[model samples]
Target: MPIIKLSVSERRRLQVFITCLLLAMAAWVLTTLSGAYHFTIKQVINFKNAPQRRAFKALQSDSVEVTMLGTGWQMLFSKVNTYNTPITVDLHTLEHSNYIALNTQIAQLNKTTDAKHRIVAFTPDTLYFDFTNRVVKKVKVEPVLDIKYQQQYEESGKIQVKPSYITINGPGNVIQNIKTWKTDTLRLTNVNDVVSTTLPLQPAKEGNISIYPKSVQLRIPVEEFTEKTLRIPVKLINNPHYYNVKVIPQYVSITFTVPLSRYTEVDEDFFEATADFSLWEQGYSVLPVNITRIPAYCRIVKTAPRNVDFLVRK
Candidate 1:
């Protein structure tokens, strides 16, 4: 076949048509990519929002660090923990900067996906921590003795106790500079029997940790006693009707032994000690005599020697 020669005008028209087709194809490819491809981002992560609940004790910050990681789309910006949650670091667990960096990286991975967002940035590759030894402090002693006793019983002796205070051990930062510890308010009324107990100690300031000894032992001495006396009542038996009865001695002396504390309650000496002779008639008779109505601790050892003679006449 023979080649045909093209004019300038025709060549220009063909070039314009081809250029337009190429432009349309490029636009179609771009649109397809925008709808089909899903990309992730990185964002900042807040260490504070990590914890869900309030930890009982204060945490150390020296060894802790925060880092955020996410899908390429998610890591685009910094991430914040919820408004109420607080993030804390354990000083004891912090050995080096790697500890802080490791924790931060873990926090980043916590996001929905492994991809890091574009807006997030991790800096200060490492963290520093400081530490010191823990210590114990002295606290005041509390007494828990009951002073109220039962009826007719009283405390008549002295009270004594051993070491009144104890020591507590805890973290140096928390224990240092503390002068003393004290127990809560205590009151005991109307206690008479032996009373002994221990009391718990509380820290004056927050964040102070203590362990080992929570309370101290307490001791109290008590006793019961009665008073002594020397007053005895008289008893009378056998009396004669026919003849006048003659007794050698009218009254007999008496004494008793009791606790000194109760000496005042037992001191009266007026009792009748007569023997009835109505049972026998016409002849002399003998009767037995005894003592009654004495204190709980008192005893009668002896009585004076005396005799009563009974006579009967027509």
Candidate 2:
């Protein structure tokens, strides 16, 4: 290969030309970067400094737009870093105004991000809020649950909640409309025994509200049912002193349904069937056998010997 070389005088001239070209390029880049540009960014509005007796709610939304002017370098950083910092809207400073004056807030944001950037205009220009007195209400807390039981099994008792009610404090309008706080939905399937768990209460629709209790304990009693038969004696009670009375059937068969867990605990001893002489005044030769007492867990189906013949001796 053959190479062409330049003399010192020719090389010196070419070097100066190249240097000039590089200087012009650098100057243009700096001029363009230092120029001003407009940018629009969305910023979240954070409410703070609320007094104990007062509550605040934005009429439109919790966030707003922030339009500003900045140099190319500042704009580049803002784009990469996103909105500088969330605008902290002080509730205490909020007063009667068509739109919230964000001059102070935007200035702070600019100081933190880059003082070279200036806030020109807010897209919304302003903000409005509904301020109301803080009010508290006591509302019942109900557990939300979906449960499935095995065949022949059912809830034996009422669902029990540890804390029956909760106290909620918030804006008067919101608190007044609320009646009850519901727990997060709970689900249980194929349950044959008691079910117990703790569930968190659902959050309020309004973000500014406060709830005293956020959780509660729930209990559900479940039991399986079984048919049972208890043979109870029919006693002759309230007999006249001069006469002796005897019922034809000494015992009566009491058939009923009982919970499987309590089936063994229940027997004829837990039941009482009696034939009263007072019924004789109704002009009936036979006396009706009445079940005077039965276990609370038992459901009567049918009884044998509904009526019994009475023998009276004087």
Candidate 3:
């Protein structure tokens, strides 16, 4: 191929022509995007103002395809931004009718968005529901916890939840099967002090089930623990013969961990060490010292002289 160089004036004219073509394309894109257009998008449907006299379960899905009328820019952004605010429909009409007309709620739905974006129609114009007898139930609230305590620290007493129970109203079949509702998992790491906070309960899986007092107050007592050792006498059990049996070591040293608040309250009386003679009759020479009873909040560390020798006298 032969190399051909263009003149300065010809080069300048070519550049201007290319710039004008680019400007025209930009203007066309802006004009088209500014015009009004119609688009369909999926939206979640939420219910409010549920009827008090009857319980209902939706027969159709909780989502519907909504046709919206807006400018091209709004439609483009709506598709790019996938967050669509759920449309809430009032269920108060359900008391008199079994279905809800979505057309009647177009005005309310438009309020949830900007004035330029209008809800034109819904694919399923009407929502149907199945009615049932409503019932009330009282259920206990169970807390779920994932806690990591500092060294030598633990829960001191029982965890208390204010409003230990909550009221639930729903279909009889559904409410009867629910015995306890749990709160969202409360997580804490390296905890060194009492924990008092409010946690929301897990949301109901079935939309028709309603829980009152959505959140509860939690009071967890935490304390630093220290080891305490006490000598507790071992009591003999199942000694029906009434023979004088002498244990080599009559008392055993019991070591346990107790919270600082109740360290002084617990003593030898708070524990009971027992040795069953029935084991000796079953052909054993030694009796195992078992700490049968201990303070509920205390954890046993060790019991000295786990096994003791005994001498039988007629």
Task: Say which candidate scores most in TM-score.
Answer: 3
Best by lDDT: 3
**Candidate 1 C-alpha error for residue 226, in Å:** 11
Model 3's C-alpha root-mean-square deviation from the true structure amounts to 2.5
Evaluate model 1: give its lDDT. 0.45
Q: Please give, for residues 1-314, the per-residue lDDT of candidate 3 as tens digits.
A: 53877789988999999999999999999999999899988889888999999999999999999999988888888886553778898888998999999999899778887777899999899999999999999999999999999999999889999889999999998899999999999999999999999999999998899998999999999999999999999899889988799987999998999999898989988999999998987999999999999987899999998999899998
Worst 10 residues of 1 by lDDT: 49-58
Q: List the residue pairs that clash in candidate 2.
A: 99-126, 99-127, 100-127
Query: Candidate 2 on 134-162: residue-level lDDT in tens?
Result: 89888999888888889888777678897
For TM-score, candidate 1 versus 2, the one ahead is 2
TM-score of 1: 0.29
TM-score of each predicted structure versus truth: 0.29, 0.52, 0.89
- After superposition, which runs of candidate 1 have C-alpha atoms over 4 Å from their true positions? 1-91, 94-133, 137-163, 170-179, 222-314
Backbone clash count, each prediction separately: 53, 3, 0
| Per-residue accuracy of model 1 over 90-117 as CA lDDT, tens digit each | 3333433223443444443445333332
Better of 1 and 3 by lDDT: 3
Q: Quick one: ranking by TM-score, best first?
A: 3, 2, 1
